[model samples]
Target: MATFEATAEAAAKNLESGRTLRELSDLFTPMAIRVAITLRIAQKIDAGRLTAEALAADTATDADVLERVLLHLVTIGVLTRNDRGEFGLTRIGEDMLVENGKAANPPWLDLNTVAGRAELAFTRLLDVARTGEVAYSAQYGTSFWDDLTRDPSSGTDFDVVMAGGMERRIREIAEAYDWGALGSVVDVGGGNGTLLTGLLHAHPRLRGTVLDRHAEPALRTFEDVGLGERATATTGSFLDPLPPGAGGYILSRIQSDWNDADVRTILSHCLEAARPHGKVIVVDEFATEEGVRCDSEDDLRMLVYYGGKERTMEQVRALAADVGLSVESLRKAADWTVMELAPAEN
Candidate 1:
């Protein structure tokens, strides 16, 4: 009995130590995954280059180092290794394919890309926490928006990720809201018109407009989505006057990039453009009483990139009230909240 008790305690301590080590080394998996994605290893594996030697030769990487990465991936269930010493894509590994058709190379998985660069900017979180400034700015010496604007390639990459990543969320938002009565809706700060196109496609009767300072890409999106006739792209800042008196106005995932003052200004623009009876839809990450459902890492990313924050429903209500808009309904769509607002009845 004494020996058994001692053995049990020893096992528990070993387990605890393993857990602690895993927690500390959590960064290793993502970095390894990123390297794999960068080398298109999943694609190569899918194409039948399963051995580390073949993959390393094709990718021009060291065979031994690549084998270590493959071994790590196998341990993490991303890849499967057979007794014959062959590696192949596991279920999760398939998602890392560079050409998975709409599900392709998720931006977060490609750490060498712009979106990944944005995520990696979190390394300077200490600077952001110290100065109440964005870590991206601290690291890159430019705001996230400015960085994107200055570099067209990075901007396009960012837009692609945003569009692809938010496609499901956009569908959820469209289905959650009632657009039967609305004739025209404006998507404020709509990037590449992805959300607008989704909403327009979901509601056939709803004609839409994409409002952004750079409307060229959005115009192209409208044309590509077969929404050229039903949608219009207009160039303007949400901080300025919107195309006035639309039946609906949408601000999706835009508020989390600004402080209260700027958010209020944007809300006021939505209010001014929305017809008295029109719906002003604010779709964003809301901190709930149940705790933040949105990615906490993403919340930190917002702080590091734009000095913005995810707001609670109560905070959103107050902002709406300040702008003479009342929250008529609040609905959860995926990880975001879709708050429908209308002019307050005084």
Candidate 2:
């Protein structure tokens, strides 16, 4: 008994020291995803029978290395390996690999993609937390937003991958809203207008305006989503200004990207654009320190990729009130919270 207890204590210490099993899992998740995408393993098995050898040939990867990765992924439940040595997609894997319909998701989760490659810098999250700044600024000497603006394509992955990945979540939020009575909706910083496009298509009576810094491709996306007639694309920065006279303003996935100071600026813009009785809908991380947490992997991604932080309901309420907005109520969903607030009273 004494020897067993001593061994247990030592194992626990090792588990918590350096990189624990948990930390290693966190570290390799994005990389393993990237490896899968790079090798097109999912694509190979889409129609069902593909030997491990075929995957290496099709993707031009080392057969031995590819086989090891797939085997490891299977061990972790990412992919399934059968007795015949054939590998195939799991339900979650299928959702991520499907090219169309509800199965379509963010390729950003795939590390081999261009955006995923750059996002791997999440290892530098230590620098971000230490200085309250982005490591990108340290290594690249520019802000994440600035880089996207300077190079238009960097933001495209987010528009397609992240937005598409979150489409199901957005659908939940859109359906939850009191759409029975509403006029105009403004999607602030709505990348490629996926949410707006989804919302407008669902609530046809509602006219939508997609406000973004890079409004060019978003305009094209309107036509692509077939909401071109009901929706319009416009240039407006929530951090700077918003379109005048909106019935409700939605800052989905926006506020958490900024610190409190910037959130105030954006909220103030919402207030200015809001009509009397207009509600400001803030869709973001609700700063919960408890159950059903934000994606820890994605949390670290923001800290490393763009130097953003997730916030809680309390943090959001304080920031909104400071910007002359009052919280009316809180609405909860599976992974996000919607703070229904209005311009401050008196």
Top candidate, metric TM-score = 1
Clashes of 1: 0
Candidate 1 regions with alpha-carbon error over 4 angstroms: 1-18, 21-25, 45-95, 98-101, 150-182, 201-205, 275-279, 290-295, 331-337, 343-346
Candidate 2 — which residues are off by over 4 angstroms?
1-114, 150-154, 165-168, 275-277, 289-293, 333-335
Query: Where is the poorest 10-residue window by lDDT in model 1?
Result: 288-297
Cα lDDT, all candidates: 0.80, 0.72
Best by lDDT: 1
TM-score of decoy 2: 0.69
RMSD of each: 7.0, 7.1
Give the clashing pairs for model 2.
34-111, 34-112, 286-312, 286-313, 287-311, 287-312
Model 1, residue 127: distance off in Å is 2.3
TM-score of 1: 0.74
> lDDT score of model 1?
0.80
